[model samples]
Target: MNFRIFKYLIPGMAVILMTGACSGNGANGVNGNAASGSSGPNSQAPAGKEVKISFWHIYNTGPMKELYDKLIDEFEEAHPNIKVDHAGYGIFDLGDKLATALAGGTGPDLAMDGIDGGQLKIKAGTIVNLQPYIERDGVDTNQYFPLLIDIMKQEGNGDLYRLPLETDVRVLFYNKEAFREVGLDPEKPPTTWEELESYSDKLTKWNDKTKLLDRIGFAPNLGNFWYWTLAWTNGVDFFDDQGNPTLDTPENIEAAEWWVKMQNKYGTKAFSAFQSQSGSLGFDPFVGGKVAMEVSTNNLVSEIKANQPDLEYGIAPIPIKKNNATWSAGFSLEIVNNKDQAKADAAWELLKFLTSTEIQKRHHIAGNALVGNRLAATDPEFMKDPDWKTVTDQMQFTRFLETPIEAQGWGGQMWKNVQAAVAGSMTPEQAIKTSQKETEDLIANYKKTS
Candidate 1:
């Protein structure tokens, strides 16, 4: 789980709260007993057969873990015949494990994919398609977030292979104090890129004698591909269906160029020491109060509140370009495709239970994670917070990373060069040409083999 749980909130954020996560065999779920079918209105377990299913997931820490454990209990309770055994795994490394397991014919019945997963992008090809199961169960996909259901369905008339468990979206956050100091209305976050640049210029602060940065205009490189966001906002596609690298498109270049300009025009030699001896990414200057505005995600909310409760932040839709498009990402519950129909059927039931509307609502109300199911996002209590609503609303403008398979084989090598150019080593023209050619060659080889 990429989630971090805090039991306690920052003063008013929660009346009684806890910060650490549940570990060991600890789960703060409902009653200790295993629930049987017909015990509740949502039961899906058939009358017979005690099936065992293994699940490997990423959320073992924080409040999200608590929420996940509870959902597991709920699933097991509803299907008294199936016992779900879950193992915790790291987000970054799970991909390798999953690939090995699937290829070797020994993978968990349920597994969580890496951070970039959307419904249609299950490239590892281990998950069972859920179309037949959903139809048989008469599941009303409309009862959940509509696109989540749509995205989880395969692009070309196939079954739903993944169920969205949760989602996080990026938003524009500006510091009210910084806005006040610069004679701008703190309530009005800039609504466009042109306004953002003009406003950012005004927000930059400097010292006379030292000529050091007192505060920055806006933080760039929050250790994320926020550049992708800028590229996205400016309308850059990583590739088209024909597998051509489009990052060199005029809009993408415009976006990346603006970022380069921001770095040169804004502060002094920043501590390029972000990559330290320990190999940890640089400290987040955003949290340290050096940044006045940023494109950020809900994933950082806990840390921000912990460090600076009175930081006076306002969230807005990310500023737009030709039109609006926000990059959204999150975790999903996927069932491994198996030749053993009995085991897969057992596991699919578990996934459906965990991602059901009732359980998803519990996750949202837990105050730790947001529900990815569309129906849960509309829960009246869920949207009470205007900020969360902003994050969820971006779902309206979401873009899934629809990278092609041939590109997938060498995307890392390509992105390494991507990082190089974005870091100023190579020109965008060079980066795109090299990466695109590599992908084309990879696809050609794949075709030759076929």
Candidate 2:
């Protein structure tokens, strides 16, 4: 793992853990704490007891759900004494559902959640620490990216609370046909902000008859690219050591300015009109041939394949600024804090199986997504795909974002400010400063009420 990458992973951990203090489930929660401290590799239930543990994950549809269903069947067949019952929830609802269950003194033996959500569970003292098991079994932690391991640990304590299942990185995707049509080299995508701007100018197509943009080369606001991503690439920390919003930092302001500049260059009225039409276009602008390049997740490749298999496109590292940086976030598997030692042990067995290199590789082959296991990511079969390889190569510079529990809805606010700036109602500095002040106020208000 690169040092630069690790630097971004845990910066918000301590601050995140400090804000969300949830109550433990029940008397069972005490047993959960004790198990983390005492459990060893050899700990087990009586030979004939037969442990049954339930797992709830967020993969209710598509290939991931199918893969999980298939893997669960295999797991049960191999360990007849252990019965694993699993269920899936919609992605947006699982975290809230898990929180509700824990508050009501019950939860699945195991569940899947994002690092930010998992940290809240850790702060509540209702997540199992896997460190003891790892130490006793001599599991090589190096098999995971540093951020995956880092995000799983308890703040100010070395206890690990979760194991990652899937991870993703942002990258630049461009249409090769568009590059050739513009007389630019399709093989050489932009590697810097200056080059991105230069290429966008060359690739953009204007319609004089309608005075509209027939083809947009690139737009800062397009795709999955966020304002925070640009800020991170330019070495801007969204929060300070004390967890205060630093949205108005010079680098952040510069990033905002650039975004607004692009909107202006494309003609704000025309840009806004085009965006409105594109949103209702029923397909990705890049896939629909309305945009030439986009910054998006690795999963976008599958989207392209599904919607426009004949399209020629290429993936590259997102253009860099002061640092080579990309943002990532993933789902992790965690054992719920409970009284049943046998149940916890069973959950651990399932965890190991799910994150194993073989399972991770199979999942990728089935769904075209990245998994937490480094060995699986580097498998010869997966490495052969140029797009997959391009994405995996970015793992070295990838960083995860941690949102403070108190600032749950801040993203919606920040994005509104972004729209205001890009629409020219606010200057870049004003937009960022206003967002900073509003977010700070949000945190301050929560602190006062708590």
Best by lDDT: 2
Each prediction's number of clashing residue pairs:
16, 0
The residue-by-residue lDDT of candidate 1 on 311-385, one tens digit each, is 777778888776777666666776665445566678778777777888778777664465766777678776888
The segments of candidate 2 whose C-alpha lies over 4 angstroms from its true place after superposition are 1-21, 30-42, 45-47, 154-156, 240-245, 267-269, 276-281, 402-412, 442-450
Residue pairs in clash, model 2:
none
Cα distance off (Å), candidate 2, residue 132: 2.5
